[model samples]
Structures are given as structure tokens and as C-alpha cells.
Target chain A: MRRAFSRRRKPWFAIAVTVAFFGMLYLPIVVVALFSLNSQKSLTVFKGFSLRWYRAFFADHDLIGSLGFSLRISAVAMIGSIVLGVALALGIVRSRGKLGSAAGLVLLIPLITPEIVTGVASAMLFKGVGLPLSSGTVMLAEVTFSISYVTVILRSRVAALNPEVEEAAMDLGCSRFQAVRLVTLPALLPAILASAILIFAMVFDDFVLAYFTTGVTPQPLPVRIYSAIRFGVQPTINAVGTLMLIGSIALIGLALLVPRLFGRRESLSQLL
Target chain B: MSETSAVRLDGITKSFGSSVAVDDVTLDIRPGEFFAMLGPSGCGKTTSLRMIAGFADPDSGSVLLGGEDVTYLPPNKRNVNTVFQSYAVFEHLSVADNVAFGLKRRGVPRDERRERVGRMLDLVQLTGMANRRPRTLSGGQRQRVALARALVNRPKVLLLDEPLAALDLKLRRQMQVELKQIQREVGVTFVFVTHDQDEALTMSDRLAVMNGGRVAQVGTPEDVYERPADAFVAGFIGTSNVMTGTYADGRLTLPGGVSLPVPSRLGLAAGSRVGAAVRPEKIWLSDFEDGMVQIRGTLRETVYSGATTTYLVEIAPGVQLSVLEQNIDRSRREERWTGGEIIDLAWKPEHCLLLCETA
Candidate 1:
């Protein structure tokens, strides 16, 4: 009886390690959340809870402009990358022999290369091309860097689709393009919507690429937040962080819910 | 009735890399006839169907539909639809929407399309499930959806690539009867492809037996079964007890040094090698009729299936003949013979078939 009980004992060490890992990861965010509601200006102490910093965040025109700019950039980047990434994924999956394999390998380069390298390279390319550094440049750079991620998420999905389904469409009196537009696109809707939401959230919170490519006037939100932190620590920054965190969590929930809306009971993880 | 051929393949040949998937072959399918292309896997039956459906282009020859050449046309331009082996139902579309897909592509009016789709759903017996998704349906229900989706288009011909190959045995048997009835009602020439010989024999009006990328025979089910063209056709269509022997004057000498009288063929020379095939059910064990060829042998084994019983008789040292008898009026199971008993086997002379080629 004792041996059986010992064999079935709870793993205290593993439980403690898991709890400590989660605590270490979330303690700083918890602190930011705690101080964002603190009503005082001090970072080390929490006073009575209030919404003053959130109100201050709404009142600052510079930060609001940056927020709007980041949102527009994310929207544009998400659309651009999804279109190009889906096309690239289709090409890579359908093209036969060496060219398809080579393109598949080349698509992985952006995903594996360090983000700092990609940021520096994009900044240099824009400057070399004599293009002005602005929100447009940031949007273009983010689209370029994010295409590989979208393809990674969507390529497996496209490949798993039955080729006969497309053939069936053509057999039913649809032209090649109509077959792709009506049948193939609808079949890939869940994955496409999932990847779109993911890319939107990723591009919104991205910092390094936005920093290297933004113009001087209304920079992206992450870049604007970095500048504010350098100047002085403000509780409103914690409020902005909390808002972005909530937005990301919302995007993830939307991703998990999109497939169910399409009558597929797939989770967000399976969509990718 | 139209006098034109429904589909005609003129010496079409296709190759993938170094292997020839389909050799030079020509066939003619009559109007409104249920034609089957029967062969084992990789015997070019599906490839030929693809060529006819315009999914594949023949390397050397042309494909003609209703006496018009459509050799280089794309599948969209051809007046034919295929029910894929996988069924390939659109998971996102409702049953009615799936049936209305081709009609909508052709700019069919909304009211007419809805009426036609409704009628088609009724024909496939999925009348009330119009608004349901394909993922909610069972395997047999999905198969009906695929059939309705293709038949609703009213194509000149319909191609089915083993559509019932995924179903269980019970469902497959039921669908076979329903498919035949639906073909009669629709009156469209169905170019069905399947490897199961039983399916080909029972469903098709005429079938083409293919072997090694070539058409070995094309005939009605009765003609093919009664008079097989070669050893391969004989063995493929059903189980035939094929025995090879040397032929002499009105007799064949087996390898075991026994001689059996065989009908003489004018084309076979003396002392030529030949193969003889007899179906298991043709050989009788007792109560033989007059003028029947009788051979004595020792019963080596008895196999009792539910409907019929088979007895293996060793005629010579190594030669064995199988005799099948229906177990219908006789319920006394203990009265049947066991092994090591001498039994006289008799079969009509015409029931034995002589073949010049081996599979």
C-alpha cells in the first residue's frame, strides 16, 4: 500500500517550477497593470485605485494620433501580406519540381533571419531607393516581414486541400479563375481569417521594424511609447500597455471563434 | 434517338515520365448506355476516364463527345461532369447550394435554379436536408449529394470514378441499385470506372476489361462471363479453375500423367500447349446427367459457406478440381462427405473452356 501510494504521489517539484515560471513571466505585466490604476505618479508604490491615467491617455492627441496611425498601418499590412502570402503559398505548393522546392526554401529565410537584421536591411533599402521614411514605409516593411509568417501558417492548409475539389469546380462549368475564386478561396476562408487576425495583432505590437522605418511626425504606437519611456516614466504608458494587451487577447479569442462561426469546430491552434 | 456516338476515344495514349500509363486505345460508347471501364489499379481505367472528362490530354490521339472532337478542350468547356472517388463535397456549402453551383455558373435564373436544385435533392432522397452542411451528413448521404451535384447540371455524359468505393458493403450494394435506377431515369450515358468485377458485371450494360494498359476485351456482361477472351479475363471476371496441359488427339494430358477428353478446336495444332478453365459451380459431384464427362477423384477438403459448399477433389497426384453445390433444400449437414473419400465428378463438355494465352 505504501509503495503504491508513493508511486502515485503528487509531483511537488514540477508544480513549484511551473508556478515559478508563470510568476516570473507575468510579474512585470502584473506590476504594470497594478500601477496603471495607482492614482499616484510614483512607480514603486501603489496608492488608491483610479482611472486618471486612462483618461490622460485618451486626452493626449499625440498618443491618440500614434494609435490611429498604428491601426491603419496594421490594417494595410494585414491585407497586403495576406493577399501576397496566399498567392505565394499557392504557387509554392502547385509548381512542380525544382522551382517549387527552391521557392519554398526561400520563403523560410525571412522567418528564420533575426528581426534586427531584417529591420536594418529594410531601412537601408528604403534609404537607398530614395524613398521618404513615413508610415507608408513602415507599412511596406511590416508587410514584407510578415508575409513569411502568413505563408508559414497558410501553406500547410493550402497543401492539405484536395486538388480534386478544384477539378470538380472546373468540371461543373467554371473557368480556372472562377474555380479558384469561388471554391478554393471559400475553402481556405477559416485559415485566411485566422492568419489575418494574427498578422494584424503582430504588426500592431511590432517595435523594431516600426522604429527603423517610421517618419519623424506621427510614428507608430510602439515607437511613440519607446520615446515617451525614454523621456520619463508615465503611468499612462502602463495604461497603453494594458490596452494593447487586451486588444491582443481579444484578437486571439476572435481567432478561436472564427472557425466555429464557419461551422468548423477547430481551435485557433489548429487553424494555424 | 440520336445516332451519334456518346463518347469516342481514338487511339489515345498517355505516359507519365518513363512509364506508359495508358497505351494506344480506342473505344466507342453508345448513347444512353451505362459503360464501365474495369481493371485493377494502375491499369489506366481512371486515366482513360480523365482523358474523356478533359482532365488529361492524350499524347497521340483525340477524344470525341457526341461525334465532335474535344481533344484539347479544358474540362470547363466540355459537357461532362465527374463524381470523384473522394466525393469532394464542399464542406462550406449547403446541400442545395452545392447542387446549384453549376447552374449558377451558367447564369441560371434564381427561381429556376432553386426549383431544379430542390427537384434534384428529392431525386437523391435528401429532400429535407437541403439547408444542412455536408459535414453533418453521413458517408452515404454525402455520396448522394455528389451524385445530385453532377446530375443536376444535365451534362451530356456523367463520369463516375469509383464513387461508391469508400462506402461499406451494405451501403455500396444499396447505392448500386439506386445508381442504376437513377441512370435509367436520367438517361445520361454513364462512364463508370471500377476495379471490382462484380460491380462491373452487375451494373454496366457493357464493360471493357483492361490489362497492362491495354483493352483485353469489350463486351456485355453475359458475353464476357460466358466466353472470356483470354486467361486473364477468365481469371479476373471470376474464380476459374485454370489448368494448363498439353493437347493431343481430342485429349489433354495433364502434368500428373492423366488424360482428359477435350473438344477439339480447329485453330489448335496437335501437341500444342493449352489452358482449360471451368467454373467451380459447373462441376457436379453426384446425380450426373447422361453423356456428362465423369472423372473419379478423392475428396481432399470440404469448405462449407452459408449459401454453397465447395469440395476439393484430387484427380491426379497434384491436380485438384473444385466442385461447388448450393446448400438449399438439404439441411442435413452431417450427411455431407468429408476428406479421403472417392467421389465421381461430372460436368458438361461445353462448360470447359480452352484458352490459347495465359495471364
Candidate 2:
């Protein structure tokens, strides 16, 4: 009885580890968020509350331009990756041959390769192709890296869909393409929207790939923050970090809720 | 009344790689008729239905719908609908939207679509469930939604691939009657494919019995049930006591030296192999009359199934016959015939069916 009770709650040792783990995880982020609202510009000391850091962060033209560029890149990457990923998933599911299964496994390589390695490799590929690094390069790199995530999330969903639904569409009066457009797409709407939200959130705050692929005139928010922090941390950077963190949380919540709104049996987090 | 063929299959054959799914099938379904394709699993009944729906193409011959050959046409081009075995109602759409799907695809106007969808909902007895999601509906209601959705367009024929197979027993029985009534009211030809013999016998205006990708027989329910064409048809349609015997001069000689007289001149020579098939309920006991052949047998077992008692009586050393008796006058537990009791059985000569194909 005592062991069962201990199992339900945790041993004192485990409880201490849980507290310490979470404390270590959230302490730095909490400090940044707390300092973002401080009147004084001290990392260790929390002064009286003020929104001056947020005001400065909004007033900085270069940082604001970088933020806007990041949003555009993330949005384009989200849309581009979703289109290519959904097409690849459908092909993998329908292609019944040896080459298909091999390609399916090979596609998962991007998910396992280190993010730094992928960033460097993508930069070298652009250099080899004689293409100038810019926001387009960052967007392209983000889309290529995120396709695996989208395909991984949507493969099972495509399989779970009933094939008869499409047939019913065609029997009703839809051409083959129209059947896919009307029936198949609507059935997959919730999953597609959830994946889109997730992909957008991932690409928005992504740092390593953006650092390697972006041009010098303007940078994505994360790359800009990293460069700014190397010189000296500013309270405005904290303000920007807090805003990005909030956006990511909101996007994650939207991803988890979209499927539920459609009354689907799956949650997108489960796919992740 | 004038009659016309609604759907016709001429020498249709389909093969999947090396396996023949449907072989040399030729059949005609009449307009406004409830035609059922009854067969066991893997017997090409569903394949035949798919061919008609244009989801599958026959390797040879042609499919004619209302005298128009639609052999190579896709399902979208054909004016037909199918109710799949799984019901396959769209979970993403509401009941009304699911019914309006086909009509909407045909570029139907909004108000007309609403009116037709409403009338269809009323027909399927789901008038108040227009806004409900298909996932919330019960199994029976989902089936009704599938029916309503497919039937809203009023296609030339509604091909049902065991649509009631997903329902429970009581719901299946109730839906069988309702489906026949709907087929009559709509006056649309229904090509229903099912494996249940009782369902086929009850609801179909005419049914085709298929076996191993081939049509065994095509006739009215009574025609097939009362006069089966071959051994497969006789056993498939319903239960029959099929036994091998040698026929000589209008008499079948049994193993126990018992001779049963049959109707004369079935065009077979003497000493030919034949099967004497009889329904269990056709054999009579206790009440004896002229023009009936009576036999003596020892009862081996009696199955009391509430409404009727089946007595398995062995007339010879190895020849056994089952006799079904209603528990009408003898409903008490003690009044039923017991095993090991000597019984006298009588059946008319016409009641004893003689098939040239022995089992």
C-alpha cells in the first residue's frame, strides 16, 4: 500500500529531481521576461516595473525590420513546406514498390541530422550554386528542413482517412481531381491547419539555419538577437524574446485546438 | 405495364492480375426493380456491383445503363450512386451537407438543394438531424444518412454493397423492410448486394445467386427457392436435404431397400445419378393422407427452437432426414417428440425435388 501510494505521488528523491529540473528549465526564461519589464538595465537585479524596454524594442527600426522579415519568411516556409510535404506524403502512401519504401526512409534523414550540420550544409549548397544569401535563402532552408516534420505528422492522417470517402465523392459527380479537392482536402483540413501552425511556430524562432543562410543587410529576429547578445545583452532583446516566446505559445495552443474544433479524434501534439 | 431494362451486363468478365474476380456474367435489371445479388464472401458479388457503379471496368463485354454503354466511363460521368458496405458517411460534414454533397457537385442551385435535402431527410426520417454531425449519429442513423446522401440525386440505380451488414440484427431486419418500401416509393432500380439469404429472399423483387465469380441462377425469390437450378443454388439459397441416389423408372432406390416414387419422365435415363432434396417443413407426421409417400424412421435428435421443433430422423442405416414441426398445438415441453422414438414421415411426390446434379 505504501509503495502504491509512493508510485502515485513520487518518492522524495524523484520529487526533488522534478522540481530541480523544471527550475533549471524555466529560470533563465523567467529572468529574461522579468528583466524585460524592469526599470533598471541589470541582468541579476530586478528593478521596479517599467515597459521602457518594450518601447525601445518597438522603436528600433533595424530590429523591427528584422522581425517583419522573420514573420514573412516563416509564413512562406509554412505554406511551401505544407504543399510539398502533403504531396510527398500522398505519393509515399500510394506508391507501392521497393523504391517508394526506400525513399520513405531516406526522407527521415533530415529529422535526424544535427540542425547545425544541416545549416552549414545548406549554406554550402547555396554557395556551390552561386546564389546570394538573403531572406529567400533563409525561407528556402527553413522550408526544406520543415518538410519532414509536416510529412511525419500527415502520413498517418492520410492513411486513417477512408478511401471510400473519395469514391463517394466521385460517385456523386466529382471528377477524380474534384473528388480530391472536395472530399479528401476537407477531411484533412484540420490536420493540415494544425501542421501549418506548428511549422510556422518552428520556423519563426529558428536561429541556426537563419544565421548561416541569411544576408548581412537584414537578419531574422533570432539571428539578430544572437549577434546583438555577442556584443552585450540589451533589455530590449529581453522584450523581443518575451514577445517571441508568447507568440510561440499561442501558436502551439492553436495547433492543439484546431483538430478539436473539427471534432477529429487526434490531437496534433500526439502526432508530434 | 411496360417494362424496360435499367442496367444490363453483357458477357462481363473482370480479372485482377491472374485471379478472376467476376467471370462471364450476363444479367439484366428491370426499371424500378429491387434486384439483389446474393452470394457468399469472395464470390464476386461486390465486384459485379462495382463494375456497374463504374469504379471497376470489366475486362471484356460492356455495361449498358438505360441502353447507354458506360463501360469506359468514370464513376463521375455515370449517373449512378453507391452505398458502400461500410456506409462511409462523411464524418466531416453535417447530415444535411452530406446529403447535399452530390446535388451540390452537380451545380444545383442553393434553394433547390435545400428543398431537396429537406425532403430527403424527411424520407429517411432524419428531418431534425440536418445540423448534427454524422459522428454523433447512431449506427442505424448513419446508415440512413448514407442512404439519404446517395439517394438525393435520384440516380438511375442505387447500388448497395451490403449496406445493412454493419447494423445489428434487429436493425437489419427493420431496415430491410424500410429499404424495400423506399425502393418502391422512389421507383428507382436498386441493385443490392448481400450475403444473407434471408435478406435476399425477403426484400428482392428478383435476385441473382452467384458463386465463385459466376452467376448460378437469376429468378424471383420463390422461383429460386422453390426450384433451384443446381446443387450450388439449392444449397446456397436455403437449407435443403440433398442426398445422392440412383433413379430407375420414376423411383429412387435407397440404401435401406426403401423405394420412393417420383414424378415420371424427368428426361433422364434409368439408373442415373440424382439428388432428392426436400425442405424440412415439407415432411409431415401424425396426419396421413393418400397421394403421399410415408416412411418409417427412428428419431436421432429433436431441436426445440421456441417456434418450431426439428426432428433429425434416420430413415435407414445412414440416410437421415430432418422434419420441422411447428409448436402450435404441441407447445408444451413434454408434448414434443423425443429422441429414439419411431416416427412416420409423409411428403407429396411434388414436394420431393429431384435434381440431376447429385451432391
Candidate 3:
């Protein structure tokens, strides 16, 4: 009877699909989070709740080393991309020509191209330049790839800025450069911080790019987890995954909340 | 406050990609005087203000400030500040910091800057709210902040580009009066740009009416409103009854064969086309005085809006004349003229202007 009525109301027809979508999305994460507290290390067995895997995750030195390396790369990459991207966004927005628009469009290619293709291309570029694949290479590649995301997020904000503020600055007393430094950059601070949070979250647990660009010994945490999974699944991997999930969630929440703290309306631009 | 000209635009012309924004126009603004540039949108008023501010460079001519040519100087190099129509207050800074921005750039002592900023905030009446960001203030409050910010520097000249356009009508009127008081207190040269004729007429010591990238006339508000040079000026500054007729032997003959004597001192050639202009209020209904041009017409409509009654009189089959009369309670409920009644219109000959060609 509910199905019969659902055929008449279109929104009712979407209920089952919506439920299944959320169920598929969160069920695995919930299971992983639930099993990270299990006592035994079996894959399918229901066990009483314990913190043995969490303890094992804390005790592993290699995992801890990889986590630290990934955190450093994420921090460096976040700052690097933001600086370059803000400059690029400002330049692109102010430049007026066909060439400028063409450059703006070209900068968006990385976002549309498959991640695997970018990973393979970066690996090949490092090889061609005679640079060995190391944690430094991963940071360089991550920063290079993440710059487009920052520019894409920031360009609209730069374009939307009121040009009169700068003119007023100059009219008051400041020179042209001083106007930009004092007025324009300060107005764009909220968007810049929002983009930084998103970039940190994206670079922290990124797998495919880091896998291709990282060193042989001390890989990023996602690469480390992939390697450990291939050898044999450890309950410690579940604990690591749960921790990364929580961290990413916190970062995403911060990104969405910062713009609103500045009285901005809700927008998809808050996300990557 | 010297007698010399504070700002001058000598033969200024500006063009953008084949469209002329300001033609070869010349204007001189008096020192410490509140001068207004009045025009419709895209009539080069704002462009003229921007040129004076050094934000825009003219293709020809020069901008002079206090007898010095500063045409090529940038805004920071010049001693002029503008309050934009958008009220472009710095969102990141507090009200006091925003007001002190110019003093800081000029390297004033920190204590002096604070005292000056405090005084300006008091002048604009936002002293207690100095610590709040501009974004948190209301629209009227933000406008005051922008005003205080520009005036704190005490620039030699202040340019306001439709600064009150963003506020509500009541707030805008309030700002206009307060701005006049502030301008007097500071004694700085004010160059105001607006499309509102009332604002220009009320606040300006003198004004220039512009159209199509050219100055139509430059005069006092009363002079422009009373003695317009041409048809456009007469119609633009106020509502007027302008009728085209043929001039022959000191008399203009209308299409309906009603000939009224033109002022011969105008010196127009015989048999030349001319326009006779008169303001609505200048025409009376019951005076019948000597040397007055008298005519009769049937009333077509009557508009009573509490204070005044406007009567549309049809002088001919298709030619209508607008006559205005004050409603000073004549106890004429039955005697007041209604529609379809013949009425006499009378005005002095000097009030009936015979306009010749004027660009």
C-alpha cells in the first residue's frame, strides 16, 4: 500500500533510493569503526568490544613514522599551494585578454583529469627531470597538483571583491600596492583560510598520487595502509582508518564553518 | 577658503573605445565652496568626478588643484579623497582604524592619530562604536564611517560620488543636511556628484547642469531654476510650459493663431523659430495686472494634492497649458473653477521668456 501511494508522489519514490545510498555510504565505515574495538583479529567473527587494535596501532613505529611524514607533507603542501594559488588567482582575475582566459581554463585541467592519469604523469615528470622519488618529491607533486584547486576556489572570490575598496584606499592615502596589501588581501582572508583547510584535508590522506610519488621506505599513511593491506589485513589498519576519518571530518567541518563565521552565506565554494 | 579656484577642469575630454564620456568641457570650482555636478546616469558627471580625483586620466586638458596642475598625479600623490556611492569601508578594520588609515599612511604620531580618529568619530556621532567592524554596522552607520574616514585626513578637496544614494529616503535626507553642516565646519572644498536635482539644488552653493558630455549651464540654483538658457535646461531643472512658435515683429504666433508679444530685447530675427517658456507657478489665474500677457482657455483637468491645485487648461483644440494655484482657502466651494470652464491666464511679460538657439 505504501508502494502504491509512492508511485503517485514523486518524492516518495526517492525515499528508498536515498536510504540505500546513505546505507551503502556509511555502513562500511560504521563496520570498520565498530571492529576497530573488537578483541579478536578475525575478519567475520563478532567479538566483544576491546582496545587491543588501538593499542597495536599506537605501538607500531613504522605506521607512526608514515603518519608523521604525511602530516608534514600536508602542512607544507597546504601553505605552498595557498601562496602560489592566491597570487595566480589575483593575476588571472586582473589580466584581461584571450590569453588570460585561456590560461584560466588550462589551470582547471587537473581537476577534471583522472587522478590516476595525474599520478602517472607526475611520476614520469620526476623521472624525466632526473629527480628521485622521495618524500620531498611527494610534497612537491602534492603542492603542484593542489594549486589548481586553490586557484579554482579563490578566483571567484577575488573577482567578487569590490574594486572600490582599493580605489578608496588609494584615495585616502595609500599607494596602489599598499591598497592591495591593506584592503584587498584582508577582505579575502576568510576565503583563503577556508581553502587552506580544504587543501590540508585533501593532501593528508590522498592515496593514488602519493603512492606513485612517495619514496620506497617511508611512504605516506595512505600508501602505507595500502601496502599493509596487501600483505595481510591487520585490525590496526581499521584503527588507522578510523583516526584518519575523524581527522578529515574535523577539517571538513572547519572549512565549512569558517566562512560562516565571517557572515558569508552557505555555498559549495566552501568545499573543495 | 581662499578666493582662488580650488579645482579646475580646463577643456577636459575623455573617450573609451570610440564612445565619448566627457567632451571638451571646462569648469572651475571655487575654494571652500560646496559645488555640485548634476546629471543623469552616463552623462559624464561621475567621470568628471573621477578625473578630478585622479582615478581617471583625461585624454586631453588638465586637472588643477589650488593652481597646481595635477593631471598626471595618482590619487595617492594628490590631496583629494572620495566617498564612493557604495560606502566602501574597509571590512577588516575597526571604525577607528579605518578612519585613521590615511593619518597612519602620512606618518602622523600614533597619539595624534588616535585623538583625530576619536574626534572624527564624534563628529559623525559613532564615537562609542569605534571598536566595531564596519560589516557589523547598519547601512546608515557604515555611510557615516566612510564619511568620517575620508574627512579625518582633512584633504584639501573632498569628492563625494552619490554617497547618499544607498540609504533610504529619510536617512538620505538626514545625511544631506548633516553633510552640509560638516562641510561648513571643516571648510574644505566639496565637489558633490549626484543625479538628484533636489539634492543638488538644496545643498550646493552653485551647480553645473550637464548633458550629453557637455555643460548645459552653470549657475546658482535660483538662477538655473528661474532663467534657463534653453529648452532642455528649462525642462530638466524644473517643470516648464515650453511652446514652439514663429517670431515676427516682437510677437510669437502659436499654431492656434494666438499671438503673444515676445520680449523684443531678446533681439531674435523676424520670422525665426523660437520657444516661449514659463514655469507653472509663474502663471496666475485672477491677477489681471497691467503689462501682463493675458489669454483664455477651457479647463481640461484639475489636480488637488492638499497643498496646491494644478489645472490643465486647453488653450486650443490640442494645445494644453499647465497653470498652478495655491489652495489658500478662498471659501469658493461653488465659485472654484471646475473642468470645462473658461479661465484667464496671466503672467508678466518678463516671466515669458523667448528662447533663442543655445547649445
Q: Pick the candidate with the highest TM-score.
A: 1
The residue pairs that clash in candidate 1, if any, are none
lDDT on C-alpha atoms for all candidate structures: 0.91, 0.89, 0.89
lDDT of 3 at B337: 68
Instruction: Give the per-residue lDDT of model 1 (tens digit) for B268-317.
Output: 88889888888898898777899887888899998888888888888887
Task: Encode model 3's per-residue lDDT on B1-359: one tens digit a residue.
Answer: 45668999999999988999999989999989999999889899999999999999999999999889999999999999899999889988999999999999999999999999999999999979999988789999999999999999998899999998889999989999999999999999999999999999999999999988999889999988888877778878878887777788888888888888877745667878888888888898885799899988899898877778888987766768897777787622325765799988888988987776522
Q: What is residue A68's positional error in candidate 3, in angstroms?
A: 2.0
Candidates 1 and 2 compared: the better one by DockQ is 1
- Model 2 stretches with alpha carbons more than 4 Å out: A1-10, B1-3, B245-274, B316-319, B330-336, B356-359
The worst-scoring run of ten residues by lDDT in candidate 3 chain B lies at B329-338
Candidate 3 backbone collisions, by pair: none
What are the runs in model 3 whose C-alpha is more than 4 Å off?
Answer: A1-15, A263-272, B265-269, B330-335
Q: lDDT tens digits, residues A48-160, model 1?
A: 89999999999999999999999999999999999999998988898988998898889899988988998999999999999989878999999998898888888999999
| Top candidate when judged by DockQ against the true structure | 1
Write one digit per residue (lDDT tens) for candidate 3, span A1-272.
34445445568557889989999999999999988988999867858999999889889999999999999999999999999999999989999877778879999899999999999999999999999999899999999999998999889889988889999999987888899899998888888898899899999989999998988979899999999999999999999999999999999888778878877664445434
State the DockQ of every prediction.
0.86, 0.73, 0.83
Candidates 2 and 3 compared: the better one by DockQ is 3
DockQ agreement of candidate 1 with the native complex:
0.86
Q: Provide the lDDT at A2 for model 2.
A: 50
Model 3: CAPRI class = high
